[model samples]
Target: MAISKSQQFFESLWYRKTVWWLWVFWPFHLLLKLIVWLRRSFYRIGIFKSTKLKTPVIVIGNISVGGTGKTPLAIYLIELLTSQGYKPGLISRGYGGHSEHYPLSLTQSTSASESGDEPFLIYRRTKTPVVVDPVRARGAKELEAMGCDIIICDDGLQHYALQRDIEIVVVDGNRQLGNGWLMPFGPLREPKSRLKQADHIIVNGQDMVLEPDPIQAINHHQDAIKEPITAVAAIGNPERFFKTLDGLGYQFKRQSFPDHYQFLKQDFESFSGSILMTEKDAVKCLSFADERFYFLPVSAKLSKPFLQSLMEQIKAITHES
Candidate 1:
């Protein structure tokens, strides 16, 4: 499908030609702000009840829009906690899932359209319990009943209704704080200062400039060097993924697709080099992949001190009430 006019219009505002469009979208962004404000108000005054899971809940979210690598990080967290003896569960909004009912557990065979791509992918990769619903609590409560000791919520920074013990904010290192403006006018889903509220700021990609090793790895797999290149990203800001690899001092002539673009074998033949891709893109591509294709999986690395602090926080929460 051709890019929608609104998408093109919203997208163009990120570059040097940003001035006038900011004026065009500022009102819409203001409306988003109003919604956020009211939401905060609801939670602040107890109009909205935020439930704490008996097992700790850690949220991985991006302040801006999509493609901050939330899904990959969730997979990493599941693996980390599982290795450490915690039975972790996952909760998601199921953004693209076609289901209309309350949350349901996801399985390896669940179609992306039924459970949403990211949640399905996480289910398939991690084999941890997975639930997707618009109301995060629906998913959380089910996860708790399913014997999940902890729940790691995906894309949940603004999900104030479901209480979280740890808040992790992920930003595309290249986008930093896109246009540094609010939504519509800029890329922020919430304001930039919300970063201060996060227990951790995970700058996805190599240019991370937070504290020493603000990004760390638990069991992240390294991509085997792809000399020539075959790659794809079905994500917002596909170029950011490509540029991150380039900045890592590894070069691959990567392919960029519109966010969530489906892959076909023909897309791979466009390049002769081995194929590399974000794990999200790999899901659809796998059906069409050959030996040339290798999925490069990356996971967040929490600094040791950060992880220790988070452990303490969880312990304290578990001990209280």
Candidate 2:
């Protein structure tokens, strides 16, 4: 399929230098920035009220428009909280989904088309209570009513309506705050200075080191064919995933689709070799996927000090409440 014009524009903003169109869009970018600033100011000044739930809320998101490993970090937090005997629930804005209802609860059986790919994937992997709504604050309320003590919001850094106790920003190590300009002219949704306000700024794919032989890590039982595979990704930053795979010493052809491109069985009919994909894409392919299809799972590897600091913050919040 041909890339959309919007995609082309975003690419120019992120990867290219000194494009004439950027100057043309500069006025619009400033307007958007001013509007965002005013909206945030309203929330800060109580003109636009923010809902604070009794249950503590932790938001995991990125300032940029594209994916920055937020889902994996949310999953990691869920697992961490679970191990500590805390009941954690998740809430998402269901970016690519449309539901007849306002707040939809997700389960392993929930369709990705209805609950959004990330929310359904989280529900499947963690089996934790997951709720999706355009109004994230309402989603948090639903999760709380379901008996959750802590809520992990998948992506709501700019959703000021939901008052979050802790804000965790996930950044792409390779792309770092591209161009450092907000919106149309660049990739940032908020200014780089916003990073200072975040409780934690986690960089994804930073520690990926080249491995000598990644085939040794694959489970032979799942795949008898030891032939080279094709690495496929339908994500915001495909290059990051591709480079990470290369670091893992995987020999594969690269195939990238537009972010969140819905995959059909026919999409894979042309390729015959084994296929590897990201966990996000794998959630959509489960029905059609065979033994040859494998997804590489990743987790946020925060530093020991960072983890300790987070724990202390959570403890303090709980004590005050």
Q: Residue 250 deviation, candidate 2, in Å?
A: 2.2
In candidate 1, stretches whose alpha carbon ends up further than 4 angstroms from where it belongs are 1-9, 15-17, 48-52, 100-102, 205-228, 244-253, 264-275, 290-292
TM-score of 1: 0.80
lDDT of 2 at 291: 65
TM-score against native, each model:
0.80, 0.89
Number of backbone-clashing residue pairs for each candidate, in the order shown: 2, 0
For TM-score, the strongest prediction is 2
Tell me model 1's lDDT, rounded to 2 decimals: 0.72
**lDDT per residue as tens, model 2, 1-321:** 123448655865675564776777688778878888899999999999899999999998888877777887787789888987889999999866778997999865578878877888888879999999998999899999999989998889999999999999988877778777777788878878889999998877553222222221232356334457888888887887888787776788999887777789899989877988877788778677776787777755666777788889987886676
